[model samples]
Target: MANIEFFDRTMLEAMSLLAESRRYLTDKAEAESQKMDLEQGLANSMETMRLVARLTQVLAWLLTHRAVHAGEMSIAEATVPDRRLGGRDLCAKDSSDAAKTLPDELQSLLSRSHSLYLRIARLDDQATARAEINTKVSGGPRPQ
Candidate 1:
């Protein structure tokens, strides 16, 4: 009878510890997931910035080339035929039209990138806090 009681108490203690460990692991996994999401968001924002930079460079080059050609043609008394470059017609009535539109679009994208970065930072903090809690619960064993 005494042996049976001791065995039952030991089983109960083991079950409790198992449950605690499971809960800790679950929380740690969730934190890691959040961290991954934040990292992905940051990566996406960086890619967008790169794309915008490339677009701006292309536009500047096109505008500079057009202005230089126009100047040269005017001096030579020759007509510069309107031609399309990179799918956009350079002789469009509104040469500055696209330029005007781009600033607003770029501004909006930058704002969104800033917001995403802030969210990522917050998530990183949350992940760190969760990891610390997990470590404390596990009695100094690092949370994998």
Candidate 2:
């Protein structure tokens, strides 16, 4: 059975990667992207934006789960859409041509972030359902 556990190594690793990826994407990757020719610049900037957006979504999901695990927010509060994963549709799109040309490290980071997000998303959904069940069992108000 799945539950939101904040201190586990998995959470640590995910948070670390999110932090590292953010720095790399915003600093190194963004810097190199500025030197591209006009067309290439547009493509690279667009791809970079996508990468940033995807990672940002993943970070939000992780933080919300951490808050729940820490008892700072109830499961129902965490389940609110704003606190839940956003940009699901944006993440759903297949990699674009520009994605293939990204620096190898950036490409890998993008893939890892997306895959990690999906895995965590599944865990979050299961945790939400379990929370609802527990609430009901305890005679607490049910999620609407």
Candidate 3:
């Protein structure tokens, strides 16, 4: 199906991005931050962690669906909302002037992660709504 193709392609891109971001955080970003003074370095470090956290949550959601596509996870098992985004409280960085001067790489990665998270959240919402509708149409118990 076309959606299966979409799923495969999305997973490939997401996983590739995960690897690239992990490498940057562990190697490049760390070293680059060390060049800053203490307070600025700590702020950079916090932003780095936030970016990584967002990416990790997105990866978890992607991997869960990958398992479903592989027939290793039931649709019901995958529908749990808590499992979707790990229930992480999103605290997006401020939009003030101080925030505008972040490194280009961090800005790019942060923007990408935000986009991916929103996309996944929308897909999850659509899937859940579809499941509820299917259940209703089939005279099965409606989703609670």
Candidate 4:
């Protein structure tokens, strides 16, 4: 019950952060207006993409667990590969050096999103491990 509440709080917070970041990006000045060089512009784009991807992954994973809790999805189903947390390769990568020049809000969003993604990824791993152990104990088919 506590885990569910914790994830619920985290999900709401992540959603709010995602919305705020979106608004900031939408209202932000164009790269040229900010006098960003080509490299800086590219870095900004990449970091922005990473930020969105990270949050999207977090939301999807949270929603999956939410469904399980709601009885709309089984725990076994949620642990499946397709339903598991994703975008690790992209979301886990370090922000580019040029991304350091981005606006402070953007930097903070990036940091927070990355941290949240990592936290959820750890949970995902733990879930997978538990599912694997359950399969072994039950002599059931292994998780794909």
Q: Residue 4: error of model 1 in Å?
A: 44
Q: 1-144, model 3: which lDDT tens digit per residue?
A: 888899888778777778878877777886777678877777777667767777777778788888878899755567666665653465243322443556777767767766776677777777677766666777866423
Model 4, 24-143: lDDT tens digits are 878883643367777777788888889989988999999899898899976777899998999999998778455678888888888888888888999999988887888788898864
Model 1, span 1-144: residue lDDT tens? 673454345335434433543454355434533444565545444433443443333333334334434464221111122211221222211222222323333334334333333333343344455556656776765423
- Which parts of model 1 are misplaced by more than 4 Å? 1-102
lDDT by residue for model 2 (66-138), tens: 8877889887878765677777777645564557766777777767767776776677687678778878888
lDDT of 2: 0.71
In candidate 3, list every pair of residues with a backbone clash.
none
Which residue pairs show collisions in model 2? none
Off by over 4 Å in 3: 91-99, 138-144
TM-score of each: 0.29, 0.74, 0.79, 0.90
Order of candidate numbers by lDDT, starting with the best:
4, 2, 3, 1
Evaluate all candidate structures by whole-model CA lDDT and list the values in order: 0.37, 0.71, 0.70, 0.84
TM-score head-to-head 2 vs 4, winner: 4
Q: C-alpha displacement of 6 in model 1, angstroms?
A: 47
Q: After best superposition, candidate 4 residue 74: deviation in angstroms?
A: 1.9
- Judge candidate 4 at residue 134 and give its lDDT: 80
